[model samples]
Target: MVGDDFAKLFRTFEHTAFRLEVRDRYDASYENESLRKFLAGEPDDLPWIQDWLTMISAATQRGLRFSRVRVVSLPLTDYSRFGVWCSQFTNGAGEDIRYLPRPEATAAGLPNHDYWLFDSCILVRMHFDDGDGFLGAEIIEEPAVIVEHNYWRDAAWHHARRREDFATEQRIERY
Candidate 1:
C-alpha cells in the first residue's frame, strides 16, 4: 500500500492507531508555510493542519483513538518547537500526542524507525531521506512484525510525556 491503498488505513482502522516519530525534523510540502513562519518568528494567520484536525475530530467522535510519541533531543530544534505548536491543534481535536527525550528512548532500546501501527495489526513503515524528507511508506501486516511494533508503541507510550506537560517543562509557551 503505497498510495490510495495506504491512505485507506486511516479511514478503515477498526479501533486504535499509534505513531512513533523519531526524527527531530520533518520536511513536508503541506507544512511549508507554517515552517517558514516558525523559522522567521512570525505568527501564522490560519492553522495549517485543519484537515488533520478534522480527521482526528471525526475519528474520535466515531470512538476511534489515536496516539503518538515523538522522540526528540533535549534542546528542541526549531522544527521540534514547531511540532509543539502543531500538537496543540491535533491534541485539541482528540489525538494523544506525547514527547520522549531521545536519550531515554535510546536507553530503552526503542527502534529509531518511524511507523504507524493501526489496531495492533497493520503497520506502515515510513521511509525518509537523510535530510528528513519523506520518500515513501510500506505497509506491513505480518503478525510477528505487528507484535514487535506493538511492543515498541507501548514502550514509547509508557515513557512519554503528554503534549502540554512537555511543552510546559520545555517552556515552549514563551514562544
Candidate 2:
C-alpha cells in the first residue's frame, strides 16, 4: 500500500500484516492521539490512523492477529495506561506492542529510512514533519530491507528503556 495520500494508501489494505517503525515523539503522538481520541468517544477526526486502530480492534473481536512495533526517541509519557488499552488491538491476544527507545532501536540495527521507506515490500510508514502534516509509505516484498529493519528492531528493543516499571525515575510527557 503506497500512496502520496493517506486515504488512498490505507484504502489498499483491509487485512494484511503490518510492521510499523515510527522514529519520533511527534510520530508517536500523532498516531496515539488519533487512535486514543477515537477510542475515547471522540469523533474520528483523523480517520486514517483511527481506521487502522479500528481494524485492529475488529480483528481482535474476531480473534485474529494485528502486529505492530513502535520505535520512538523516548518513551511515551503514559505508555502503561496506553498499553493496557492498545492490547485490545494487537497480535498477541491484545498484548501491548513492543515499544523501543531510539538508541535501543539503533542498536538493534533497525533500518532507518525516511518516510518513503515504509513503502517497501515489508513495512508501512506515515511520514510527517514538525509542521504537523502527514503522508504515507509502504515497503512490501523486500526481504533484505526487512532483515535490516529486523536487526535494527532487535538493537532498539534491547536499548529501549522500559522505565515505566521502574520506581526511581519520573517521566515527563514533553509532547
Candidate 3:
C-alpha cells in the first residue's frame, strides 16, 4: 500500500501507531529536494512537512498516540541528520519520536526491516529498494507476526532515546 493508505490506517487506529525505522538512508523521490537543501546547509524546512504534522496532531488530539523509533548509524548519514532536524516538527505535533543507534539496535535484536504496528496488532511491513527507495508495504495480519513485531517495538523503544535528547547528546544541530 501507498503512504496515503498508511495515513488512512493511522486515522482508524484506536490507541497507538508505532513505527520502527531501521534504515540509514532513504532515497524517496519526493524527499530529494529537501534532502539536497539540508546537505547544502540550508534551513531544514520542507514544504510537505506541515501536512504530516497536521495529521499527527489530529491523531494525538484524539488521544491516539503516534510514535517512532529510528535506528541510525553512529556517524550519521546526511539523511539521518536531516531526519533528526525534521523530527522537531513531529515531536512538537505530539509524536513521540525517538532514535536508537544502529549498534544498540542490532545488539538488541531488532528486525532489519522497517514496520508500522498499529494498535499492537496489525503490522505493515515496509519494503525498500537497494538504494533505500520505498517500494510498498505489506499488511500482515497473522497473530504470530504481530506478536513478534510488538516484542521488537517494545525492545527498541526501551533502548531508544527521545529525539531531543539524542540530538543534543550527538551535537546534531536542527538547521
Best by lDDT: 3
Clashes of 2: 26
TM-scores, all candidates, are 0.93, 0.49, 0.94
Model 1: residues >4 Å from true position, as ranges? 45-47
Alpha-carbon RMSD, each predicted model: 1.6, 7.0, 1.4
What overall lDDT, based on C-alpha atoms, would model 1 receive against the true structure?
A: 0.89
Which tens-of-lDDT digit does each residue in 42-161 have in candidate 3?
775678678889989998888989999999998988788889988988999999999999999989999999999999988999999998888999999889989999999999999999
**lDDT of each model, Cα atoms only?**
0.89, 0.47, 0.90
Error of 1 at 137 (Å): 1.1
* lDDT (Cα, 0-100) at 28 in candidate 2: 48
Backbone collision count in every prediction? 0, 26, 0
Candidates 2 and 3: which is better by lDDT? Answer: 3
lDDT of 2 by residue, 53-94 (tens): 665566556654444556655444454434433433342334
Error of 1 at 113 (Å): 0.3
lDDT of 1 by residue, 1-175 (tens): 4667777889999999899999998887778888888788888744668877899999999999999999999799888988987788789899999999999999888998999999888889999999898888998868898899999999899999999999999877634
